[model samples]
Structures are given as structure tokens and as C-alpha cells.
Target chain A: MIRRLSQARERGIPEATVARLPLYLRALNGMAERGLATVSSEDLAVAAGVNSAKLRKDLSHLGSYGTRGVGYDVEYLIYQISRELGLTQDWAVAIVGVGNLGRALANYGGFVSRGFRVAALLDADPEVVGDHIAGLSVEHIDELEAVIRRRGVSIVVLATPAAAAQQVADRVIAAGVTSILNFAPVVLAVPEGVDIRKVDLSIELQILAFHEQRKTDRMTGGPAMAEEWPEAVDL
Target chain B: MIRRLSQARERGIPEATVARLPLYLRALNGMAERGLATVSSEDLAVAAGVNSAKLRKDLSHLGSYGTRGVGYDVEYLIYQISRELGLTQDWAVAIVGVGNLGRALANYGGFVSRGFRVAALLDADPEVVGDHIAGLSVEHIDELEAVIRRRGVSIVVLATPAAAAQQVADRVIAAGVTSILNFAPVVLAVPEGVDIRKVDLSIELQILAFHEQRKTDRMTGGPAMAEEWPEAVDL
Candidate 1:
């Protein structure tokens, strides 16, 4: 089933487009749950916080999933988006680093709702190894390889601390995982054909801070902000 | 200083591009720290994990800051990016929810490096108030209003659990914060002009899991895989 979907993806869809499909799926599901059977591009766009044109363009890439007169059939759209995102298949995920963030991710309600299952929970510390988290018992990090093979887990989520992320990533990759969702701050160097997506909280915060700072700066007319040339600075 | 940058942003720069200025600034600073005086678009793009063309386009939105032949002056580029990001003025930030993630952000080096100062930490827990964390004392949630006014805090970082997130966000908005970095899973409703950026670790992980599932399905051509879809739910 998964192979067939990959073949479908290979038939032409870009990965970037695939990533946004779930967001669309979530919005459509919400509309369905609200008892709305059909939605126009405008309605879905507002709910998803995206531009209607972009949404329409994105859906167009998925091949006329919506009607010309009607916007979209909520249930049918949900299934189509799910299929495009490759969410119509089961995926067993292994999570490393059962710390606060790790545990939070494991316990996150969104993960279970989107079609992914947490097959294994792992921690390096012996103290946390025997602990039960989100209905799954935390396993020792040493058992990662065996568990990955046993569960046939292909995707790994790294919620480890910055210092340990790379090491954990290395071990996970060595265990035969092909895709990684990194929550740690540092970058992970993956071999060709492997996919890595990073979610750095600090980085996101910094980006927001930058904009916030700019907004505040504009409100205050201070001369110290004289035009400066663009130059790289050492941290 | 911040005002000028904000005006510049309003003039024409895309909000998405504006958000990346701080990242470029940080990367430039890192390069400078290593004694680098100049960097090409390619070099900086690699450090930033962005394509050279996209990086160039983002910078171009801020005006032609980079020289065609010389690439970009390290120090000059850093200054320009920092100024554009409004990092020249220190931003007083209030961190709500003194949980593990909050503590981690409080201790994070990125914030300090980019002109964001942790002005106050607040929590609803009575026992946590007055406790020292990372050199700052955690204050009671009741004091949020007073602290925001006294310190002129303009940005709030919501690291609270989902249950308390909306309440915290409401209070923060009422206290006059115009920009928020929400780490909570829930959607925050803010008045017009208030910016809210969310970082959902679980959502990101689930997106990766979706792709991982596709990979596995593609690898194994089994008929039973079609039945795996209904079981592969994400929270």
C-alpha cells in the first residue's frame, strides 16, 4: 500500500505540496465535523489562514479535486488530501529522548489524530527506561535497533536535547530509519535520499522576535537605528 | 531604531521574508565570530539550510544589500540584517508558563544574541512564584499586567500547556502585547494587527510520520497495507 503511494508521488507530486495537504485535510475534516458538506475556496482558505488563490493553486496541483460551482466536498476532499499526503497508510514511528518535549510529543493528541502511531518510546537514562508514557513503555536507547527492526519503523522523531540530537540521529539512521523529524536546535547531516525536517523552537521564537522588534522599533523614532550596511557578524 | 526598521518592513518587504532576517543575522554573526569577513550567497545559504536563490531573493527584498561580485561583506551584512530585523533595540520579552520548555527558552543563547531580553517569567503556580530560574525569579501570573506595563514589554512567549494557553494569551493581549510566539497547540485569537506565530512539535512530527509511512508502504507491496490506513491515526 505504501509502495503504491510512493509510486504515485514519483509519478509527479512535489514534496513541498505534499506537506501542505495535511493542513488542508485538517481544515476539511473540521468542516465535515461541523456538518458542512461543501466548502468554497474562500471558506477553506479563511479556516486554514492561507490565501484563497494559493489554496486553489495548491489544490489544482492535486488535479481538480474541487468543483467549479461548488468549492469542495468536505469528506471527499479530506480523503483526497489524505491520499496526496500519503496519510492513507499506517506508519509506526519511533521517538527518541523522553524528556519534557519528547514526552509532550508522545502525549500530543495531534499525532494520534493524523494517521501516525507511536510504535516505540526510547530514552537513554535507565531511570526513565521503565516508565510508561502515553500508553507505551519507555525503552532503553540500546534497544533502538532491535525495536526499529521489530516494529518495521521507518520514521524517527528526535526530541532529544541539542547536545545529544546528532548522536541519537546517527543511531536512528544506522537502525535503518529513512526519514527524521528533528526538534533539536542543531542541523543533522543526512545522506542522499534521506529526508530531514527540523522544528527548532528557539529558531521560530527568534524569527518572531525579529518581527516583533521591527514593529516596536517603528513605533519609536530613535536615531541609533541609522542605516547600516549589511555585514556578517561573529556571534 | 526599531521604528525605522518597522517602517521599512511596511514599505514593501513580505512578512515571511522579514521573519528570516534575524536568522540571516544570526548566521552572519556566527560567521563573523569565526573570523570570517565575507561570505557568498552559497556559503550563507548552506549555513542557513536554504537554497542560494531563495536566500538571495529574501535579502533582495530588503534592497540590494549584497554586492554582485564580492558576495556580501560579513560585518556589513550582519549589521544590515540586524537592523532590518530590529535587533538594534533590545526587546523586553515576558515568558509565560515556567515549565521545562519555558526554562529552556529562558536559558537559550539565541534570544540574548538577537536583542531579546527575558524581562520576566510568569506562572500560575503559587509554589513556582519567587523561585529563581536561570538568574531570574519567576513571578505569579497575577503580576503579568504590572510587569508588562513596568517593563514596557511588547512581546510575549506562550509556553504554557494547551489547557492554559488561551487564558495566558488573552491576558497577554489584554496587557497590550502585540506580538506573540505561541508554543501551545491551540489556536490563539488576537485582535487585528497582533501577530501570532505557532511552533507545534507534534504537528511537525506527524507530517514527517506521514511521509515515513509512504516510504514504508512503497517499500512493501503487500495487500494488507491498504487496511493500515484507518489504524494510522495521529493525535
Candidate 2:
């Protein structure tokens, strides 16, 4: 992981680590808001739903910001983490698909307060291109590359359908964008240096289904122990 | 963590383990499809994007399924994980909120292949309540409890708006449902023994932004070494 971090530093932070930093930041902020001046590794770990050892090791890669005996100053740690995560600077972002999900993202307070700024909204349908959404006029998909380059966008949000996701990703990458947050279900293959993160709602539900099943299994008994008659299987 | 796992097992498998089981299954299935009969811990770990030791440890909880020298049989491991995850049993799931995202979930193919079966579609809006969605009629929210009971639904997917999620959750829980997969951004404070797992798309993006920021900082040679500029003070 450390090697991945160093490589990310030389090129960029590994997409995985980049994804987790906000979770840690949120936990630290919660501690700070609670009037806790300092927090032990264990305290932050629990709040972030991660292990303390891993937290300490992750923090170590950035720099020795925590006191050995006193733990970490919550405010200072927040600033450090924020700085490391580039929260100190604003990032211009473009949304490729101006669908319901895209509109929700635009109106979402979390993205606005954080480092990301939704610079433009684009869609393939010409009828919806000039439509006003979240106070911004939606642009045609033809303007994607131009708008991305003009705005100096480094991050692109792909909310398009599965069929259009790869095409949008290709255009976004061709426009010099390095990081992409994909909501499409398909597995995206990007260049070696580019970073792509997927957020699939169906996949998350399926994962939960797997766990909910286990819960039912344990309630009945072991896997081999069947209590009632099995219903017809569907697939 | 182990203690939490034990406690979770009392209810079912730990939510953490549940989340990873699909990932493991996906990797194992990939191996099987590739015509590989067996995979070592290291090989499986790489495919699953997890550490080899952690993979071995997680598998150990199931049983000593892997040989010390020969590793694990791909098809056998897939079956074991599937059974442990309750994928062997079909779970009837009701999606409450047939909006753009919910409609997408209802149509997704992943759920059918996995343990989940989208048995019902629901909406609070009168106009949409009777509309057809993915071959299922969108039932009114008033019929939620009846549908859940009739279907013997052990799992409920909350794709409702953030404002309505809690109310829906209350109704679902009152109907004896114990597991919830929440897509809304708000946190659901469930009663003990009830499992709630959240998947927030915006949160994932914020996390990615944080790390993307850090990468840019390192490449620019840290704040201290960067050239002094008037805008630096603002950051």
C-alpha cells in the first residue's frame, strides 16, 4: 500500500486511498465538532469504520502529523488531511449525463461544500441541452471536450447510460481529464495513469442481499440444515 | 472486529463480510470461467484486489477449505462463498421508490443472477403507483406492509428520497423486515438486531476528490516548497 501511495505521489495517489481520505476526514471533523481537541488513533478508527493500525499507517504516508503520546490534534489533523486531499483548492468538475441522478448530484450539498465545483452539465439529447438544471444550462454532448478543456477540468462525473459510459470516458480522457467518477454499471478500462472510481447502486443492493441471506441462514441454523421446503429457484 | 463479526453472525454474517463475499465470489467465478481449477491465496487476493493474508483469514472463518500447499479449488470456493452468502436461497426483495434510480435498480440484471429477486415495485406518487416498471406494476406505498408480508420479504431496498427514507424504513421494520439497503444519503439509526447498510454516491465522489487533491499537491512539491503566490493565502 505504501508503495502504491508513493507511486500515486509520483504520478498521483492510488484511486483507492483517494477514495478513503474523505471518510477519515469526516470522522475527524465529527470529533472536532464534538469539542474533542485531540483524538487517539483508535477513536478516529472507530468513527471511520476502519482499523487504527491502518489509519496510522495511512496518515504516516502523508507525514508525521500526529503526536506519539498525545495522539493527533483534531483541528490540525483536519487541515492536514484537507490539504493532502486538495480540499484547500477548488476542483472544477463536469457531469456528462444530465439525468435525475445528475441533477441530484448538482443539488447535493456535500459536493458543493467539498472541493468539487460542478462547472457544466452535458447531455446527448438536443431538446434538453439548453434546459436549466440546478441554475446551470445543460450543454450539448458535442461541447464536452471543449468545455472540459476550457474549464481546466481534472475530474469528470459519468452519469450516462451503460452504452454511453465508455464513449463519454473516452472523450473525457481524450480531453486531458485524469480522474473519473463513474455511476455506470460496466467495468471501465482506463489508461495506466488515469483513475476511475465506480459507484453502482444495484451492485450495492446485491451485496446487501448477500448479507441479508447469511442472516437468514444463521437464524435457521447452518447451511446444511434446512427447516422448510425450498421454493422453485429463479435466475 | 472479530467480536463484532461474532455478534453479527448471531444475527447473520457481519455486514463487512457480506459486502466482501460478492467481491470474492466475483473473483472466484472469474477464475473458474478462465478454466483455472485452483487458485492460491496470492492469486485470489490479486483478483479480488485484497491482501493475500486477509483473504486467507476471511476464508478461514468459513472452514479449512484450502490445502496448505495446493491452495483452493476455484469452483469449490465459489460454491462455498455462495452458500455462505445465502445465494443458494432466493430472497424476495421489494424496491420502494420507482424513481429514475429505483427503476434502474429494478431493471438491473445483477440482482437476478445473485440471491435477490425484485418481487415488487412501489412508489408514493399516485400517477406512478399504477405504472408498469420492469414487468411489475408499481404498487402504492399504502400497500407496502401487505406486499412485504405476502412476499415474505426478508430484505427491503430503500431507494426513496432522503426525506421519505426513514418513514419507509419505519413501515418496513414494523412489518418485520430486519435488513435494509439504504441508497439515501441520510443515516438510518436502526434498532439493535436490525441491519442497515448505506451506499451514498456523493460520499464516494467526495472521497475521490480528497485523494485527487493530495496527488496534485505531491506532484506540485508540497505547500512549503511551492512558489509563493498571493492566491496561496486563500487556499
Candidate 3:
């Protein structure tokens, strides 16, 4: 994992920049769909909801591709960001635990629109097994290693309950899947060389609540830490 | 939104720091659950998976709360972070799109533990409407404005299809939801003072794939942009 990171560092693209690349890519894709051939940094920034100068700085790190006045060629820029983000290659993904979240993930359009293919879905529940979702049949957890090996799934998505996350993570790691996107609300412990990214709805909501509190604080003009909830938002 | 932001600034907490407060809170909560008392910056940083120096800087923004020699009181730190994150007061949330994703969000335990109450669930589909999920009966989309008004739901979770996301966002915004956590694959346009945060699973997967590609590049010592697959991950 360190070696992999060093390679990104060697190219001088900060992880922050790498993360935002997808956001920009999405915005650019939208413009392309609208029949726009080129867009200025400012316009792209507005679409991507980022500062133009910051966007310029980020793109500069990738190499000077934007023009002085013509801005950036939309299709060419799309290829550049997609290539940089490794979307040019198809990646086989296995989603473990065919629960609500897993089912939603399977049906998500963004994955297919990009290069990610949900190759397999696995669940422990006998009731959920043998179910067809998004054109793929849900397999039992007993078929995990076999399915992973057979399907050549390099990435795993864990949508299991918190109690089962760690065990499933361990098993998937042993099955040779190196990357995992976790949604189980648990702190997963993976050995060296594994890459895990967590998307916790609770954490996201808490962050929003912090801002919501700030909104209330401004409205009441009281103490910043006041215990009162702001009145109904009429705005 | 600008007013609320200014209020947050008045309290001297940077938005970037505010974004990370939940991470520290999560790490601290995990430790508290394990019955830890005092934790050094390095220990806490490791648990939070952030740079220790950066972590110290972030905490310093909060004040001289963490004692240098003895580290920080785990419970106190949790309280500080929680209060800073506005988790002390319960915020009611209504989720639109009672699809698979909505069901998963309703079942998630982290929300309640972090002081977010899923007050209502709404959906537009005739089939999904009236179905019981995660103990809440899915309400028709017609009740959206009324429910938001009646239930005092401050946050809206958009899990609708891409085609319906923008329309749902418009209605919710009109109904007075200022904070939105969007799970749909579309970028929502909100009026000023309203906050919108998007979570795109496809983008996350693409990011992991970038690192995975880098890992493979290191192993092969070949060009980073190999046009062919490594062939182990079939399908």
C-alpha cells in the first residue's frame, strides 16, 4: 500500500487532488452530454462547485493540458481524467451481503457508466439467496471464496451488518481482494497492502448537523453552544 | 447559508476542520467503547487514520484542550467533538426514495447513536409506497411537503433515481430543507443558504481502482497505463 501511494506521490498528484478528480470528471461528463465541446476553468469550476484557481492548480498538477484562452477540450479532458483515475480499464467488483445497501449498489448506474462492473453478489441469508437483482443472482456466503476466484473479482464492497464486517473483511482479504469499499459502520482492520474506504452515513449526517447547528446559532444570535433548536426554516 | 457559515467562522472553527471533527469523534467513540481514558495525539491519530501533526493542528483549532504530557481525556474529547459537531441535539431527517438504499439507511445504527433521528421515509413509486421498511411505512411523495412541515425534518436524504433527484430536491428545498445528503447520481442545484453534500459510490470505487492500478503498475514495472487487464480478475 505504501509503495502504491509512493507511486502517486512520485507523479506529484496529491491524494486530495486525486479524490476531486472524479468530481471534475463528472462535471465534465455532464457538459459533454450537453453538447459542449470546451469550457473555461471558471465555467468548469462553477459546474464542479470548486474555485477556478484551485481547479487550475489541480489540473496543472496533472500536466498543462488547458489552453490560455480556449480553456479545455471537453472530450480530451474527459479521457485525461478518466485515464488518470483508472476508469479506462474495466474492474470486476464483488458486493458481499445482498442487503438493502448492496441491492442499491448493484442497481446504481454510475458504476456501469464508469468502468466498474458488479460481477457477483453474495449473502448469508437463505431467503435472499437465489434472488435476481440487476441481472445478477445472489449467491450464498458459502460461495464467497469460490465466487471471488471464479469471477476474478478484484474489489469487494461490504454492506453487511457491523458485527459481520470484520470477519467478512478478513475472509475477502484472504481471498486475495486488495480493495474494499465498506458501508457496515465498523472500523475494519485490514493487514498491510489492503486499501479500504468507508462511507458512513452517520458520519456524513453528523457533519451536516454541525453546519445545521451553525445555522441555528446565527438565527438565534445567542451563544454558539446554545442548546436551543432553531425555529422552522422558512427560507 | 452564508449567514450560517459566517456564524461558524465566528466560532473560529474552519470548515475543513469541521469536516474532520466527525472522524476524530468516531475514533474517540470507538476508544471510549473499549474503556480507554487518555490518548496521545499519535495514538489518536493512528485510530483516526490521519497525520498526527495535522491532527494536533486540527485539535489546536478547538483550543488548548489536549494536555501535552498526558494527551487528551477520552470522554472529554468525545464531548468536545460531539458538541462541536452539533451531535448533542437531535436532528430529525427524512429520507426520500424508499428504494434499497433508503431501506439500508433506515436500518443503519450509526445515525441514532450519533444523534440523528430518521423521522420519516418517503417514496414516489406506487409499489414502494405503503411498504413497511426498517419499521417505517413508506409515505407517498405527495406527503413530502406536509411531512417535512409536520415532522420538523431538518435534513433530507435523496436516494431517488437520477431522473427524479432534481425534482425531489426542488420540492424538499421548497418545503424548507436546507441540508441535503444526496445519494442519487445527479448533482443537485440548491439555492444559497441550503447545503448539499453528495456521496457517489462509483467515484469511490474509481478512486480505489486508481490505487489498485498503481499497485499493479508497481508489480509489473511496466507503463502505468497498460491497455490490457492483468487477467486474474475474470468477468
Candidate 4:
């Protein structure tokens, strides 16, 4: 696995391609479950919702070129992609902020299915610190560094409120975590070499609203609603 | 607002620019709170995590050209971007599934602050239905169509399981929702006219793990761990 990953690093797969590998992996897993032996790039592309050309190009980064006529072998492709994504070994993950989102994430089956274990949960609230969620007792935030060290947590998920996110991020990074999945709304400033991925729910809705407004404006032959501040700006 | 939007539509902001507008808006909101009436491009870009050049280019899409030395009026920029994103009008959003994720979405305060109202919550399970979450009663899935129409829901959020996502999507689309924010781990097949954005938590973790693995491999000067199937493949 390490050899393949070293090769992957030497080849340097595009970040966009890295992001899509899980999608392809998910599609391939479904195919394997259905008793399929092989899959054409076209079928897999459709399953993953990408164009066939793009899918083939992405797979090429992993040094796997499917046989032209017979297509790609399903099991082999799953194994290859899984190895490339480092999913062959389970990763111990810790989530900070035991709010609704944190609890939801702990209970989410998707992470466990993909070789990720929710090893620890931490929150600052005294009332919430001892609560049991997803069969694990929530530990107080003060034990964050100890919990991470004791449980061998590698990646930390930040679902804390905006005010607490940065402080929690600082403490975790200082504890030697390099990878973070942030669900807080703030843009965290991390030191060099740390990987931070943010998931903001409101941002998604705002993007949808932009397109939805365009559709409504088209139907109405102009802006769908008048501005709250018509005289607010002259632009 | 209508005139500005019509002009904005004519200018046709890049989708990338539209996506980043919210970031700029959030940064500006923080500045506004801090009593910063105006901001230079460089400072604003730093806050929004983008370069000054890119920030200027994105703002240019809205026909905004900051003063050469003084920069932009923060309040005016906020209004313009909000209007462009259609956040000027409150959007009634209904969430389907009412699972842990669904409940999280319902209780999230960020949406309300950004002109999105969680007008209704619907779930298929009788046990979950009728429960109050975030001050709104969880309506039965049978009332999905009715609640959407009655509440004037223009956008739908799907937090359903992978199995039920498509069915709920089809129903909501048929009920006249043109926008959807899907958190399910499935590739939803929606019509071209509809806009669907997916947020897969597991995918994010997998991406982080890929990088985390790479970082570990680099530290170890090779693959961190040996392959489970050394003899499985010759490649």
C-alpha cells in the first residue's frame, strides 16, 4: 500500500482527481455488490455522474488503464482505488463539538463503511461532555490532547460554533494533528502543511439560491423580487 | 434590486465568482461588525482566503471597481453581493428525511441569518413525524407536497438516506422546487433545469485521509505501511 502511495505521490495526482476518487470508489463498490465482474468507463462514469472522458483521465492518474474491449475489472479497480485513497487501513478520527452535527457525524454509518473510526468525541460544554452519543461517552474538551494521543487520532473534525472553532483548531494542531475537516462557518487560519477542509451548510444553500433566483428572474422577465434597499446604492 | 439583478444577469458572473461571493460577504459582515466602513482589496482578500487579484476580478463581475486608494464601501458591497446571490429575499426551504442530519439543518442558525427560512420539516417515519425540532413540528412525509406549496418552499434540502434520496428528489422536483441541496451519498439524477449540490461527509474524510497518508508516507520516507495483498497484483 505504501509503495503504491509513494508512486502516487511521485506521479502527483491532481487535487480535483483526488477528490473524485471516492466517488469512483463508491460506484465501484456498488458494482461489486451487484455481482458485476467488469465495468466500462462509460457505465462507471454514469454511475459517478461524470463524463466518460473525464473518468478515464482521472483513472489514468492512478496508473490503471482499463482493457479497451473488456473494460475495467470491478474488484481490481475497487482495490486499486481503495489503496490509492489509503482506505485499506482504518483511520482513527476524533470529532470536536458534540452538538447536533457532531452527534450526527458520530452516528453516520458512511464513515465506518469507508475505513474511518470515530474514536473519540469532545465538547467544551460541561452538560454535554458526559453525554453518550453513538455508543461512546463524550469526553470534556480539556482532555482533547490526551484523547487524541491516547486513541491515536489522526484527523479531527471541527463542528464547533464559529467562536470556538479557531481555538479548538489551534489546540488540535498543537497536539500534532495535520488533517482537519472543519464544519464551522469561519475560515480557519492554519499553519503551513496542515490540510483543512470546510463544510458550510449555509454556503451551499446560498449557491442554490443564486441559481434558483436566476430561474425565477427568467420566468418573471426580470428580478423576481424588488430590492429591500433600492436607494441603498447607486451602482 | 431588480435593476441591479437584471444588469448582473446581463453581465453573467462566473459560477466560480458567484460561489466566492458568500465568502466575501461573510468577511465583510465581520468587518461591518468591527466598524470597518471601507476595506482595501488586499485586506479583504486575506480575510476571504483569496488573492487580491482574484478578489478584484470577482468583484468586477458585479461591475464594482473599488477606488484606487480608498478601496470598497463594505456596506454597499454587502448589499450588491447579497442582491446578486438572491439573498435579498427570504427563501422558504423545506428539509426532507428529518434524520440526525436533517435535524441539524433545521437547527442551524446560519441559514436564518442569511435570508433562508426553514419553513417545514418532513419525515416518513411516524415515530419521527410530529416531533418539534428547531421550533417547527416535523410534518409527515405525506405532507411533503402540501407543506411545500403551503409554505411557498422554493428550495428543498435532502438529508435522506441514499436509498430514499432519489425518490424524495423526484417528488420535490415534481412539486416545483428548482433547487436542491443533497447530503445523501448517492449520485442523484435530476433534470437539467434543476440545480443539485451534494455534500458528502464521507467523501471529505476520504480526501483528507489521502493527504494525511501522503504526509505520513513522506515522513517515513516511503509508504507508511505495507500492502495487505502484496501478491494480489503484479503491477
Q: Which candidate tops TM-score?
A: 4
Order by TM-score, highest first: 4, 3, 1, 2
TM-score attained by model 3: 0.82
For residues B1-235, what per-residue lDDT tens digits would candidate 1 score against the true structure? Answer: 1223444434767877765665577578779999998899999988877789989989876666677788988998887777666666777788998876777677765445556788899999898899897799999999887787777777788888877998888777776677898887665666776789887665675567556655666777521222122222344
- Winner by TM-score between candidate 4 and candidate 3: 4
Number of the candidate with higher TM-score, 1 or 3: 3
lDDT of 4 by residue, B5-121 (tens): 446445677989988999999999999999998999999999999999999989877874477789999999999889889988878778898888888777777645667777788
Over 4 Å off, model 4:
A1-9, A221-235, B1-9, B221-235
Q: Of the candidates numbered 1 and 2, which has the greater TM-score value? A: 1
lDDT of 4 by residue, A27-130 (tens): 99999999999999999999999999999999888875478888999998999899889898778889899888888889888756777889899999999988
Stretches > 4 Å off in candidate 3? A1-10, A62-68, A191-193, A221-235, B1-10, B35-43, B51-73, B221-235
Q: Write the per-residue lDDT of candidate 1 for residues A30-62, one digit (tens) a residue.
A: 788889989999988877767899888777776
lDDT of 2: 0.73
Each candidate's chain A: what TM-score?
0.86, 0.82, 0.87, 0.90
Cα lDDT computed for each candidate against the true fold: 0.73, 0.73, 0.81, 0.84
**Residue B111's lDDT in candidate 1:** 43
How much lDDT does candidate 3 score? 0.81
The residue-by-residue lDDT of candidate 3 on B8-113, one tens digit each, is 3347687778878888887888899999999999999887778999899888776667776899999998887887787888778899987767887887666567
Model 3 Cα lDDT, one tens digit per residue, A1-235: 1123333334757888888899899899889999999999999988887899999989877777788968999998999889887788777788998877788778766545667777888999999999988888888999998877776677899989888999999999998888999988777878999999988887788878878888877876432221233333554
